[model samples]
Target chain A: MTDVAVIGFAQAPNVRRTDGTTNGVEMLVPVFQQVLGQTGLAKEQVGFWCSGSSDYLAGRAFSFVSAVDAIGAFPPVMESHVEMDGAWALYEAWVKILTGEASTALAYGFGKSSAGLLRRVLALQLDPYVVAPLWPDSVSIAALQARLGIEAGRWTEEQMAQVAVRSRSAAAGNPAAQLSGTVDVAELLSRPYIADPLRAHDCAPITDGAAAVVLAAGDVAREHCARPAWITGFEHRIDSGSLGARDLLAAPSAAAAGRAAGAGTVDTAELHSPFTHQEILLRGELGLGEQVTVNPSGGPLSGNPMFAAGLARIGSAAAEIMAGRAGRALGHATSGPALQQNLVCVMEAR
Target chain B: MTAPLSAPLEISFDYTRSLGPVLAKFMTALADRRILGSRGSDGRVHVPPAEFDPVSFAPPAELIEVGPEGTVLTWSWTDHPVDGQPLDRPFAWALIRLDGADTGMLHAVDGGSAGQMRTGMRVRPRWAAQTSGQITDIECFEPATQPARQSAAEPAAAAAGQAVAAGQAVAGQVADGAADGAEPVTMIITPVRLGYQHTASTEESRYLRALQDGKIIGQRCPACQKVYVPPRGACPTDGVPTTTDVELPDHGIVTTFCVVNVPFQGQRVATPYVAASILLDGADIAFQHLILGCAPDEVRMGMRVRAVWRPPEDWGTTSENIDHFEPTGEPDAPYESYAHHL
Candidate 1:
């Protein structure tokens, strides 16, 4: 097996709504060109193309099919899709390179979350036959986990407020972030709860966006960029959909995936936490010490773009390793209701 | 131009789910207004029993009477309700561990505001005004003020692990054709309806706009001299966009066709018609359209046809503006001329 590294990455500015359709062709066309141009590669030279999206998110089946026009895939390119986050799509592409399938691959994810009520669509992810009929809004589920942790003394409202504060402060530096600002916990605490024990800031803003990442095998990586963020390890797992059968306050899937991915003692980590309390739960589960810088790209709390947010996490973490700023970094992604599934990827600068 | 318009569209279907045997027994019990739990191969009682144990991957056989009362394991408050939620008003969603059962179930709780609801609070099932095999059979779980009359089917009093001894006592009261705790028998049909504006591609859009002016336009692919009636992003064979515009005659010969004996979803026309793929006089690719003014069996390959337009008022930016194709009254083109198109 050969090593694959991130050679180029690009994303559109996160926004409340994009005039483009939910299929994501309009948004993907320019980014596809930008990332290819950055690496000095043409569309014809790319070896593999894969995407991540969901039918429930777009309110239709085979939603990703029409987007192929952006690539002008008349000759039929080698492609596959996962009804998961784009970070997982990148993981699949990375594995292909490792198995010696192709030297270069492109992975992308796009969602128009603003098209439908996002909270409503998310209900479909729950146990469809047993639980989904009740239609539990996602915020309420997170709040239930938040209150349990608060009662058990695992964390506090003040501590959760601090995570939100630092996320926005770091986000102010990212031009693509839709929401950012320095906020004081005292002022935020005064606000009313959307779900008890959780404030609006504790939740991510509904966003619509697209993102792409380019992966190249061994020599291809060195030729495109001076410093490459070579992948060291990756793993993912899923827990039963029965929310009652498992512990809600902690994520076993994240812990298992992190350990399998060799995520230990990294200089920085990018975690995907749509809710503030999840960040606290995930940090302890992944065994990240206080020294590791987390969410320097503002994370999902500022602008959670559904399918694209997870891939953005990988892109954000790779940026640190590519800039010669970090030696080892970890990128984590989650899906299903209340983090029922998880994935972890570790990369090191070389 | 007209201002764009929109409306709420509900794409729904009953989704006929075939519950082989395990799920059938469960649904039948729900119809009898009873809560039945199935004991899995692992000795765990699962509510709304699963078809197979996820871990053991085997069918569940044992049965237990659970619910009517349970304790909340974890509770979440829904502040902003989404479409199809059990309650439009604010409510608490909880994981309730039913009495006499080993596992828990998820449902809505209506015990007042956020402050009153606690994780360990006791609640009872609130049956719906009507009974069905669906999950909606239980309206919501609410605070149980006092002990209610317990159903005799509940063997909670007979002592635990009495499976062999207790089977005879409960056998008499079992509903006719009920599996007790196996699976439910019901068919739910979920209808899927999706609507799209179905915009034409940039090249096709230009061709349609020109059609409104009664000018037939074709674009010539640079790699191949073949003309494309509706220009494409890339040639299907050579993989390059058409670069030069060319004029073409609409008079084309029928390449091939299939008879419409069966009606299907989203059919725009009546049955007993012919849908033919026509290769225009100079174009390389074929397009699908309806053939009329002839018997279904008479519409043969290489039959010459011409566009039949609908009244002008009904015309818009759509190929449907050309109602159907009618016989040109000219001699049928020779089979040798159009055989390759087939």
Candidate 2:
């Protein structure tokens, strides 16, 4: 099998809102240039291109197609798209490389989540017959999960607040991050609840951003990067869509994906947890010890750009390995409600 | 310098979904002011009935009555409610476990305030004024006034048999109604609406701004030199911005066209009118516009047309500045002139 590795990664500055169109051409253009420049690879040299985005977020159909403009896709290029996060697009690119169909691939994800009422729009993802008809907004749904974990003794509100504090402080180093600063855990708790059991700081801000990662196989990877982050394992798993049926405290899908992707040994981890409690939940589910540095890039609690944030987790993790900051790293992405679906990618420096 | 042009964009549609057998039984029961649960392979009853047995992968064997009242397993308070929620006032969204069911069901609770909501509080259905075969038939849950009765096992068993028989009868009515045309409710229509502030690209904003001044402006792509009107954020072919501005003539040739003989909702133009792809001289792409002032049958590819402006007082930041296009009495351009555009 061809060994795939991440050679380049770049992301747009995470912001509360962007003046750019929903097609993401404005946010994507600079990031695409940055990633290509980092790898010293020409646009034509990319063998495959894939992206992840949503029409629901944009309030229009076929929204992802316009993003192809950033690729200068003239002369026709091999491309595909997923209505999921860019992390899943990277998963597809990995398979494309393994299939020997493409030696170099670029995966990207973007979202102008600010274009619409984000939490309300997410209700469409629930079961149409039963839950969605009630129009349960996303924050209330996460709050239900948070309370479950709190009452079950799996985690506490103070611990959840601590996660937020750490994330914001860590984000101070991430120039592209939307939120950053030192804050007291007591101060975060003193804040009023937007959704009871959840405060404004506990929730990820509505953000507009895009991210791209370049993947290459074997010698193609080495030629472009001085030290490529070799993908040792990549896997994704999903739990039942029925929110009430599964145990919210235990993310079996994240656990299963972690086990399959060999996430146990990573020295650093980046998790896509939109809500603060979710970061705590994922840490337990993935079995990362106290020693394993988590969310060094501040994670999604600081700046979650919807579809792109999940992909950015993978890019951030691989970057740790590529920059020689860590020997092994794990990047995790999640979708659906309350971490119902999860993807884990483990990368290591050779 | 200025922020790109933006406007409110609202999209809405009714999504109709057909419920299969399991949900058909579930919803029909709701119409009668009763809650139903499906028995799984593990002898557990799933509320809002699981269509397929989670473990056995088999369709529900029977749906039993679970709750008109239940216990809240976990609850969260919503300080403010958004549109389309069960209540405009603040409420508690809870996962409730009914008396006879092993699993919980998600719904809203009219708990008044966060202080009143607790993890194990008892609640009951607040039926809608009108009962329809829909989930909203039981509007929202309210705090139960009385403690749930601890009826003996024997009476509960008898009640389960009666509920199962009632469910089968509803299913039977649906089966028979298929022949008689008095169809039971087997489908649900959910009207979904989302609003967005749709922002145009910087290049597009520039073009719209030019239209306000009675000018047709395009940008030339630096890589491919293709002139795009209402300029693109990036050239579709070159993946680069079209930096150089190019002013296009109002007169152009029709690259392609279609005669609208059939009318649609909200259509402004009359039937038998021509909608043409106008390839302005010096522009690489054709934009769709109404081709008027000529017989529909006379509108042809390669025909020369000129823009007809609305009153100058009516001009704004809109393409509507050009009311429509009319045939120019000039000779038709050669086929090769626009064959590449098509």
Candidate 3:
């Protein structure tokens, strides 16, 4: 079987909003070119394409279909889509390569989360019969989880503020981050709650952006980029969708996926935690050692572009290896209410 | 203009769903002014019952009665509420571990302020004036001592089944109106509404701007050099933004088309009208538009047509500027002229 590696990756600048259409053509086109340029490959060489996005976020149906314009999809391309974060889309691309269906593949995810009331739109992901009818917004839902963690002594409001401070300080170096600046944890704690126990800094800013990654199997991967980040292990898992039934403080799904993917011994981790407390919870669930440097790209709290943010974490992790910043790294993504779903990708410089 | 054109867009839909057996039992209990929880594989009961045990991956072993009272495991204060929430005013959203259930259920706590709500606070259901099988059956939770309106739960003890059906009353599936079933929460209508500030791309904005001024403009892609009307954000073949504006004649050939017989929501055109893909003389791609002033059968591939503009006063930054297309009476272009587009 051919071993697939992420040969190149690129992301658009995360911003509160873009003047472009929800189809994400403006954001995705440049990133596609950037990734292709990094690999010294042309768009025509991309054999399989997949994407992740939500029609609810775009305020339009089949929004990803229009996004293919950025791929230069003439003569038609074998493509697929997931109504999930882009990291899941990358899994599909990797499968295409490993199965010998394609030698080169590209996976991308994009969203104009700013196009709609993001918290309200997210309600659609809940159980259609019970919870969604109540329309409990996403922030309040996260706050509920955050409070659970805080009350249970698993994490605290002060510590959650520290996560924001560190993420912002780390993000100052990432030009693509939407929010980045050094702040005293004291100042963050002093801020009033946007949703009780969750401050403005604790929740990721709603952003509009896109990202794309290029993958190649074996020799083709070596031909494009010099130090490819090989996929040592990749796995994903989901918890039951019952928000009331699952333990709010525990991300059993993340832990399960981490254990399955052999998520040990990575020096750097790019986690997709939209809420600050979630970062703390994920650190424990994924069992990252205290010494492990997490979210050096500042993670989603600094700049979360919804559908694209998860895939960007994977790209950010691969970049650490490709840039020789780390010998091994892990990328994690989440979906649904309160980290109900999770995917983990572990990569290493081989 | 430095800023692209943008407008408020509102999209809405109603989704109807049927409840499975496990949820049906739960809803029936709610209607009877009682709460039901399912015992999971772990032998713990879950309120707002789990249809299947998460740990066991099997249907719950049994159902049990749970709470009208519970303790707040954790809660968050919402200072300002959005539409459709359990409460419009300030409230605390809490995970309440109802009495007799091991797992917690989520609902709003109608506390006066944040200072009043705390973890481990005891609360009780503020029953609605009218009971419904829906989650809203227990309006919202309030501090245990306060009674939430008089219990309208037992509207008529004599009419047990009728009262239960009334508890299930909702828009699409009016309880009394449903096909007879003692415990079928078979229909749920979810109304989804979203608002957006929809913006046109720089290339598309230019095309639309020209359309407003009564002209047809297109852009040529620098890489592929294809002339595209309602110019694309990226050239579909090269993935490069289209550059170089080109003006084009409205008269063009219909490369392909379909005669509409089915009617859908928001469709203005009459049935049997032709929806055609017009390939303009200077453009390489086809744009969808409608054909009128000719029978649907009269519309054909390779036929020449011209835009029949709405009265000039009716024009704006909209494709509606062209009311429809009409036969131009000019000779149909050779099929080769548009075979590439088709």
Candidate 4:
């Protein structure tokens, strides 16, 4: 296995809706070119390519198939796709690198959530025969988890409000963030709930976006960037899909992934928590310390692109290391209902 | 400049699942309006029973009726709904263990609102308007008014195993264990009917409109000099757009061939038919199409085929316009001529 490092990362400005098709070719083509250009690596140079997206999100089956044209896969490329976030796509790419299949790889994820009601499409992830028949909206499901945590005295509504306040404030500087501005936690807390416990601001806005990350082998990494964000550890796991079978307030998958990835200490961390209370839930689950600065790019609350948000989190975390803003960073992604699946990637400047 | 177009689209298909033995019995019991669970040797009554015992890897023998009513072990409120769901309105989704069952079954509960639902609330089955040997036989579960039955046994006809259908027999063998020398069996013909909003890419939409005019258009890749039938943003080889417009004829030849004798899922043609890849003379790639107007066995490699179009009145902006390929009856080219193109 070769020591792979993130050489380049690029993303489109997250928006509430993009006129472009849900296939994400229009949104992703430019970002693919941007990342390749930044690393001076051509698309043909990428030995292996993998993508993460979902059929439900695009309101169609085999949605990723059409995106093949974006790659110009005529002769065909060694590629596979996961019905998951782009973060998992990165995990597959890393696994391919570890197995010595490819030296340079590209991972991407994209989604246009506004094509249909975002929350409604997500319900399809539940057990198809059983729970899926009820059609639970994601916000209501998250609220149920949030209410349990609040009643159990794990966290307060004010604290949840504080997380949103800080995330948006931090996002003010990020040009690509969909929602960003300075606001007091008390003023935000005064707003009415959209799903009882969670305010509109507490939830991630529906966004259309795409993200691309380029990884290279040790020698290729050294040649591409002055400070390559070497992936020190990468691990992921999926818990049971049954919402009733597992604890919602605590993400066992995130904790398992974090411990496996050695996500103990980091100067900066990017967490894909579309809901504010989830940020608190994940922090306690991963056992991150107070020293770790979470969501330096304002995170998913500012603009959450369903399939691409997790990959954007990893890309942003690597960006911090590349820009010399942080020495070590942790990137986390989640999937399924209430963080049923998770992936943690730890990177450091080398 | 005009109002955006929208229409109601429904993608629904009754998937015929071969349940092997365990699930088949379960479905049969459902048809009889009874809930049955199979008990493994370890004494676990699994609802919609497992085909193979998780622990002993043996098929279950004991069948029991756990309950028509069960408590919700855990539940989530559904405020939004998607197409094809049991309820098109808000409801509580839950995992309920029937009175006699060990593992819980997932279904919708008619909680109506978040305030009416709790994790431990009990619910009963709401059978469908008409019964079918499908999961939809049970519409959903609703709040139950009373507890479940406690009988150990009830008067009923003895259960008997029936001869597996030929189609299901192959599926069962494949399910229980991998089989060798299995002639490509047509186990299933799943007609997938997924309706997407099919928004074409900007360039492709333009080409589709041009196709409506009965013209063949090709986009030329500057680097490779290959003209693509449909314009692409990235050339498959160079990963760059095919920048120029070039016209190509609709005629092509058979590059390589495969006789799809074995019937499979979503087959549009009859059994023992030949589905081959035809390379349009000017195009670099070959696509699948049916070889028609000839016996299935008579279709040969390098057999020249041409697009037999439907009547002009039946034309549409789709590849379906070319109904099927018919034998051009030209002399067969030598095998070595197009073997490499394969």
TM-score of chain A of each: 0.98, 0.99, 0.99, 0.98
Q: For each candidate, what TM-score against the reference?
A: 0.84, 0.94, 0.94, 0.77
True contacts kept of each: 0.37, 0.86, 0.74, 0.29
**lDDT for each residue of candidate 3 in B108-209, tens digit (9 for 90 to 100):** 888889998888889998766655567777677889866555534553221112212222433333343122344345555555566888888988888888
Candidate DockQ values, in order, are 0.27, 0.51, 0.54, 0.20
- Tell me the deviation in Å of residue B16 in model 1: 1.4
TM-score of candidate 1 to 2 decimals: 0.84
Highest lDDT: give the candidate number.
2
**Per-candidate total of colliding backbone pairs:** 20, 1, 0, 3
| Best-performing candidate as measured by DockQ | 3
Q: How would you order the candidates by DockQ, starting with the best?
A: 3, 2, 1, 4
Alpha-carbon deviation at A348 in model 1, angstroms: 0.7
Q: Candidate 2: where is the Cα deviation over 4 Å?
A: B146-173, B176-183
Model 1 C-alpha lDDT per residue in residues B97-191, reported as the tens digit of each score: 88877766888887678888887899997665544455655667787864542322333212111122211111222343474453334543222
lDDT of each: 0.76, 0.89, 0.85, 0.74
Residue-by-residue lDDT tens digits, candidate 2, B12-59: 876777778888767777767788899999998898899899999999
lDDT of 4 by residue, B92-149 (tens): 6566789987776766676778788776788888765444334445667788864432
Q: Kindly report the docking quality category of candidate 2.
A: medium
Candidate 2 chain A worst ten-residue window by lDDT: A128-137
Model 2's TM-score against the true structure: 0.94
Q: Candidate 4 local accuracy as lDDT? A: 0.74
